[model samples]
Target: MSSSSSSSFIIRIFIICGTIFNLSHQIKTIDALQPMKSSSLFIVFGRPGSGKTTVANKAFESLSLDNNKNNKHQQCIELDLDVCISQEMKDNFGRGIYPSLKERNVFASGACDYVEKQLDEKLLKCQQQKQQQKDFNLSAIISFSFVNTDLRDIFRERFPKAEWILIDTTEEECTKRINEREGHFYKGDTPDKKKKEEEVDTTTNEEKDMSDWEFNPVTFPHIILDGNDPIEDNANNVVKEILGKNEEI
Candidate 1:
């Protein structure tokens, strides 16, 4: 080959190699600038007496066991809104204070505020560790009766990426469960009366209580489990989903 042609071929190869190197470096730099996500928050919610507490407790236990088995640095934590609210009432009013049904929402709002503060602190610590290039992973499972869009929005705004699980049950089943409940104050609004209709069915008090409680398809999508299912089965399903999400991190 002529010297002129050989020189042109060598110059083309050099240009191609240099372009590839520059692109690779740019990709690496972009990746390094992105922060690592080391935290996961899971919200378990449903109507009152939907068996959310039982399933959430069992799921938390399973996740804790899995974390221990894997020797993961990630901490698994469970937060029950009812328990927190009860503690707050006891601390303020006294141990004998019957959780007032009328004041429940007020107390619940306060409890949510407390949890939000605690979460903010935990996230701040995670961020500090992240800046140092150290891992500080956390997994929190929260149980609550997020009966309305407003209540659910509190967490949705805080943790946009949070995963949600819903325990779904019929209104009749929920009333039956509430009737049998011994400790909780929220007995169904009309525990004794059963409403029926001859032609057009009207909304009952149970329906009214659950009027605003709905799963938003767009704003709040969730993994749903049957409330009638055995606790063990529901718990296993939750744990499976949680593990699957964690794997993505």
Candidate 2:
């Protein structure tokens, strides 16, 4: 072959290689730009008396409203594991009975174990559903009692893709809120009120005597927010972070 023809052939091969490389880069960029298709699973974790439930509810409401307003194809579900377990305990025991925080601690620990098992089952169900429908997504916001580092590590290992948000509230504030809400347990019954009044003495002491639960973040990447912050604002900030709207907020 002529030297000029050989040079031209080499040039043509180089152009083809460049085009393939450019196309691959563009594909990667496109994937990055695309909205994440995987359903986002979030765990709202904190100690008892923190605003985990409140924040979870706020996020649930916001997501529900957004879905209705925009007719978005995504679905968000909030699963309050504590509430579910508490109700189950209540039903098993009897009606018109309340568990003390200490009793609740025992209940929550066991309930969390059960909830985790249920989550595994649900994941399997979701996998089967996904095989039939490509657009089907299952998202969950869960609130749980996070006591030790080991539990945190387990959660991190189990749900590596999910986001964890910790509600950080001062002990004093949590106690105050708990005290205010305790009134609802008695309602307008006089005997119930008297019983509750007597219980307050012990409850106050219990609250004051409670130890601080420390959060060590050696295992999971978590975003911590002030529990005292307005629920609406906190929810919005969380949503923004989850959607990658604003960083370092």
Candidate 3:
């Protein structure tokens, strides 16, 4: 089935399931939330080696094609969460072996601060252009794993209106890719340990702690995409939603 049809079917199931329990009144319109006008913050979330950055970049390209046609002063940037950490943390993390949770936490905790600092600089630049009576278009794509749910509090309550794109991929696949990929923080000089999380790569016993590991779609209005799919292909799907091409009737 087409992606849109799949979404419709899921919603129908939700509606029917709700009605069966006499809780149909609780069902609300399930719409894809758009980013704030003129300035947008698109969060591209997934696990390590799950193509989050590739997806974010492709989505940014689409953003330009769809939103910057007439704007002369347009600015778009992609911020990888790794930038939040110091060089020492990144270099020492895993010591060229698997992933390091301790160092990752520092990066995760400082995500909000990093985004605000980036936006502040961008807005300042926008103000300068506006002073010259020119219009400015500002947008961003923040790509990160956010393996810990606590990292979400860094944004949800703050930038509640930002667009969220979840790249869903299997933990096994992510681990395999992380081991195969070269020159990534998750890789090692040789095969090392698996980066396990109570949330992202949960064991059978830790199922109850699932929310602590991965981002939950039901908690908020967001679009879900298969991370294993081709980057540009997945990106086009997201663009269709942003441009309302796949918006349900």
Per-candidate Cα lDDT values, in order, are: 0.69, 0.61, 0.63
Question: Which window of 10 residues has the lowest lDDT sum in candidate 2?
Answer: 183-192
Candidate RMSDs in order: 11.9, 12.3, 20.0
Best by lDDT: 1
What would the per-residue lDDT of candidate 2 be over residues 1-249, giving only the tens digit for each residue? 999999999999999999999999999865544434355667887755677888888888887787558633445667776554554544422332344446555655665566555555555554544421334344567776565555555556556677788888776776566556653222222454346556736445555333323444435567888888898888886666554521211
Clashing pairs in 1: none
Native RMSD of candidate 3 (Å): 20.0
* TM-score list, all predictions: 0.61, 0.53, 0.61
Candidate 3 per-residue lDDT over residues 13-83, each given as its tens digit: 99988787664333421121222234567788877778888887788787776555844455566788776
Clashes of each: 0, 0, 2
Off by over 4 Å in 2: 1-38, 84-136, 183-219, 245-249
lDDT of 1 at 194: 25
Which whole-number lDDT from 0 to 100 does residue 191 have in model 2? Answer: 51
